[model samples]
Target: MTNITLQYLTQEQVDQFYRDGYLRLPHFLSPDETEALLTRARQLLSDFSVEDHPLTKFTTGDDNHVGDDYFLTSGDKIRYFLEEEAIDKDGKLTRPKEKAVNKIGHGLHELDPAYRKVTLENPAIKGVARDLRFHHDPVALQSMVICKQQHIGGEVPEHNDSTFLYTDPPSALGFWIPLEKCTAENGALSFLPGSHLTAPITKRFVRLPQGGTGFEELIPPGQAPAHPEGKYTLEACEPGDLVLIHGSVLHKSEKNRSPATRFAYTFHMIESAPHAVYDAKNWLQPTPALPFSRVLDDGPNASVHPAAGRV
Candidate 1:
């Protein structure tokens, strides 16, 4: 008999996710919760100083190196990066702090109390992970608040999360939630349904031990696997909507041209199994390879596996 405790999503929802490679939950957060997040986001934006902020353009179009000191040192701390295009010829911010930032990230779930209370630390998250039936226990990997700045929000090219956080057999998933409304004008996500079924990871973003970063291709150049044509779908999201994206899905968002800002919080999870291996060169790993947050409690005799070293 199936255990009742493992049920978070209905069987239909689960089946739909596997079939389409994505799932949308409209009421993932309450209006009150959404408002709180929005307020917090605004405060963070307003308070963030631009005097020494690193201009980090948000890009996922092609495999690019991210070996700067700022990028390498930000995995465990709350830091802000500026929109690359928003800088003036003098290499300074062209707009105020409120409109110049690109993202605040890579650690909100573990460092921010507000985020942790509603996400990683929430029981529902673990329950959902259990229901997903991951190959091994799932652990929260990377967390960030995507600040889709008005008029300067950059485009995010189609790519899979596994390309950046790959496991030996490829196990990764995303949890994205908007704190404000997201629309086509403000760069909402557009996905190719069932893309995960056909699309294979093309390359990986890796970093050298000494310094620098680059792509490690898995397939021949220009011959990467692709999904079927004319299957594109765009989502118009409300403040509380949640999106679950599969690791192999092909998805992207356009540049925000609207005057409104589209802010969202997102994070990814991966399996921590003895057989799973994380490449030592991945760009976003914690420097010391700390144990990631576990989705399931370690029962009696539950021991940490070797794969836990990379998470």
Candidate 2:
């Protein structure tokens, strides 16, 4: 693992994050570090077999959200999800499995060495969390490598991170790092500035009581604040750049129509203090064997392996 000293955000940068609800830091990771992650992701995609694997497609639209056992139970395990367009009408894959996968998610930070080094072992990430005033020992969860595959990548609808990873006081934050140059043609992220201050987390994605998943309303009907329109700023980033996303910020990315693919690693951190209650019904829940990893205090036991057949 590469040794990275603690890198705290400047006062101006912290101010910008609060004012705009997002911050882009150039060269957050070295070129070699970024390439290492991309290589590992490609290797995992190549090694994953589709013989008996369920072709679960990940979607972010209002309707057709993923609610299968594979998705709901992936919180403590590393698993793959396919692109919506990768499947044909006959319920078969339209392309090779490696090219069809949309993402590998939910436990990479704790289960995979490459991701663990950058997320848990890197002092830079801890420093950033501290700079943001997440003094409550923020717990990192829901790590994923989003492969915006070429030509067949699907579009992500506008949404907030807190909708999926809800905390009682709603203190979720996202760390997004692209492994390749992100461009608008290849599905770069676009953010609605300052929406975090105005937008309310009115609904949360949760595991349904009877099984599967559904969205539960957090506020009374018609009581949510209105979202702003037509002000999304595209954030095209390089391989080593880092984007800090506020939990309530409205953001989305377009389909990758270009020949190039956009591979990015992302994860969320939520306050774990007594005041910030993590809902038990949240779609992603930590198991007793594999609890959520703390950004700071990565002791000897920070890394652990999932049980047999879990990953």
Candidate 3:
């Protein structure tokens, strides 16, 4: 929930973006900015702890919150994750504490400087880190993903950000930021070259049929795929470097057999617009299978919750 205005863009940067559809913005957030976001995220988790966290209904963890099977499939889990559970409304998690909030969930993204909205990833969510499954931001066409890997096998899958999500043409930007040092051993991202500039790629995705792994690959293979020049490997990055990507790009994460958790954060960006949630004009929306991030409209002086201005 950082309060940031889009003012740092330069002519050269814009040109690069036009050429590649994405550009890396290193050290965009100062240390203070990043820390402030971490604080806010921790605060939210603390509050969820105090209150009877109601979002537990949508989770079914097999290995603690590390690997959860949700009743809601296809859509992004955030929608169902945040929804008030009709059944287990009592926020008490049935799963062990190890699964409740994993250490990796601490990878917080430093959004606009104000640090207003922070994306929270529980162990259950990260445990499902099998594949991106090819989707995109709908209206805002922007999202941020952050994480820290404590296990040696935490990896991210690859796919076009908008392959099956939307077809309005690539106007979305994907930003990957690291909270901790990222190296090949720690699990960095690998991408395809000039793939983002090519026309939108669309094809029916048929899984292995027997459900090999939930979060394995973002793009489940269907028919033959165009051989987009797969010639890009993101350079290893330091603690504060960020990789900005185009929505049309094809990318995936590498192996992470390291002893410690690989900590990183990601954000999806779309041009500012109105009525963005469900409109087709935007192509980055999640596929028919994933849930969607609804359009949020808060009236004047609105606090995140209705409790604000209450007394």
Best by lDDT: 2
Over 4 Å off, model 2: 1-7, 298-311
**Positional deviation of residue 70's Cα in model 1 after best superposition, in angstroms:** 0.5
Model 3: how far residue 115 lies from native, Å: 3.9
Candidate 3 residues lying further than 4 Å off, grouped into runs, are: 1-7, 39-114, 117-144, 164-167, 203-225, 271-311
Q: Which is the winner by TM-score between candidate 1 and candidate 2?
A: 2
Write model 1 residue lDDT over 5-60, tens digit each, in one string: 43578877777777788888888888988788778878888887666666765555
Q: Over the stretch 60-94, how does candidate 3's per-residue lDDT look in tens digits?
A: 12212212233112123221132112223454544
TM-score of each: 0.89, 0.92, 0.53
Give a tens-digit lDDT track for model 2, residues 248-272: 8899999999999999999999877
Model 3, position 36, has a per-residue lDDT of 61
The better-scoring model by TM-score among 2 and 3 is: 2
Alpha carbon lDDT at 9, candidate 3? 59
State candidate 2's TM-score. 0.92
Residue 301, candidate 2: alpha-carbon lDDT = 21
**Can you give the lDDT of residue 109 in candidate 3?**
26
